[model samples]
Target: MTVPALYRGLFDDAALFPPGDLPLPEAVPAHAVHRTAWYAEAVGPFLVGAGRLAELTAVLAGAPLRVALVLPDGAGQLAPALADAGALSVAGVELADPDVRAAVTALDGQLPAGVQAAVELPRGDGLPAALDVLAGTPYRAKFRTGGLAAGAFPTETELAGFLAGCAERALPYKCTAGLHHAVRHTDPATGFEHHGFLNVLLAAVAGPDEKLAAEALAERSGALLAAAAHDLTDDQVRQARERFTAFGTCSIVEPLEDLAALGLLTAPAPQEDR
Candidate 1:
């Protein structure tokens, strides 16, 4: 099935990450299924930590897999991680480092051609400078939208600032963690607030205005947000996606289910037996 351009390649599989923590053995096959599934176009590369490349290779046994290598330990681990990724296709690299400039410098001349890199900037006073450093470069930016703790989830204002910053620089970016559903809501079990992926998309399409973006992020009405998404024109979707890019989610099915619930995605009719 042809996925909508707005949602195509929007979800990066992070089954191995926290919460879901699907074992590498299970994740490998599950990812393979997702790749061939009808919703395949909506999925992006399988995410794995840099340290897990060897383990991932051992399990794959030469089966081709595209991966987004996560460098948690920062720039020092990038070279060795890429070296270990020889057995698999490295689709992209994500570097989480406090020193954004240094990480960008270290990343220069290191990644293989066609493999995009995103530096996870510290969401602090230095964010603008970090964005400035990444502007006009081939690299993209990454933001941590949510995590295990309450503090890990950036407030609507903060996230709006981030979207505005990226828009101003025209720097493309992807999000990680905390965006579990299609609409913004507090998790009933954990009581932790989570940013809805749909809200983020609408906010990005709102352009560089921090206030408008913040309002979109703060909106909790599913019908309203879904309506806004449906109202988006082809050019609007293209421009928004060009800046917002994709986001990482632990469960690919969760987002798919959410989108289906929002009436954004319709399941294909089952085939009749011959």
Candidate 2:
């Protein structure tokens, strides 16, 4: 029942996890990991430069690890560390450079073996091109949008479209931002904002039920979670359960371990590989 824990990006601060209702031991594990990166969501703007990043990296690398780095640009940011690391930046395009193809191929030469890389695509059509550019590496991809504000949620159709696009492209991308709580609960304290996996999960399962699908998409809170999950047939329930058994978790790390007490996800296998 060792659940997959949440990796708080630079945005989540030390205070974010401390106020939870969960027990002290469970609420704040010996080490709660945070990240170091430059972004609006950055936990501490003053401490996000190169020096803080190095320190945070070192801390997370240690036992009882409580900090981490979700480098938006994995390799490009770390290229200096790994002489072979290659970094791809978006100097032209709004979200990415307009001429990424040339830049990528240019770095191909100095890109040492196992050099990591990341490309930020500015607008539409960049998805495919990005997939093509980072094709043969351990590179992972992320999609960004402008509407993660307090109460801004993309249209139901828009989210479905995005996820559909991911499915169509066979892209298993990870999401950051707007997802912080277990359900769609509001951040009682910060009033900042957070969207948990439960909503995403419900939306994914709602494809067959258009009405149900629409309701979940329009709302930005966890209200839909309880309802969307309602009315689902036994078969659908089973399917959703299977999905959860797979990679489903809106990591409230402490309580998630609680669910495993109920025989939810299969017990993780040994770490022989590790």
Whole-model Cα lDDT of every candidate shown, in order = 0.92, 0.37
Q: Which residue segments of model 2 deviate by more than 4 Å? A: 2-51, 57-69, 72-78, 81-140, 145-155, 185-194, 205-215, 219-274
Candidate 1's TM-score = 0.98
TM-score of 2: 0.46
**Model 1 residue 237 distance off true place after TM-score fit, in angstroms:** 0.4
Candidate 1 structure lDDT: 0.92
Residues 1-274, model 2: lDDT tens digits: 1322211121222222212323323323322431221121212111122223344444334333322223333334433433211122111111123455643553454444543333444335555566556445333334442233544434455445544454444443333344544354455765644444555556545544545544555566444454554556667655443322122112334323332332332344556865
Q: How many residue pairs clash (N, CA or C atoms closer than 3 angstroms) in each of the candidate models, in the order given?
A: 0, 8
Candidate 1 local Cα displacement, residue 273, angstroms: 0.5
- Relative to the unseen true structure, what is the C-alpha lDDT of residue 159 in candidate 2, on a scale of 0 to 100? 49
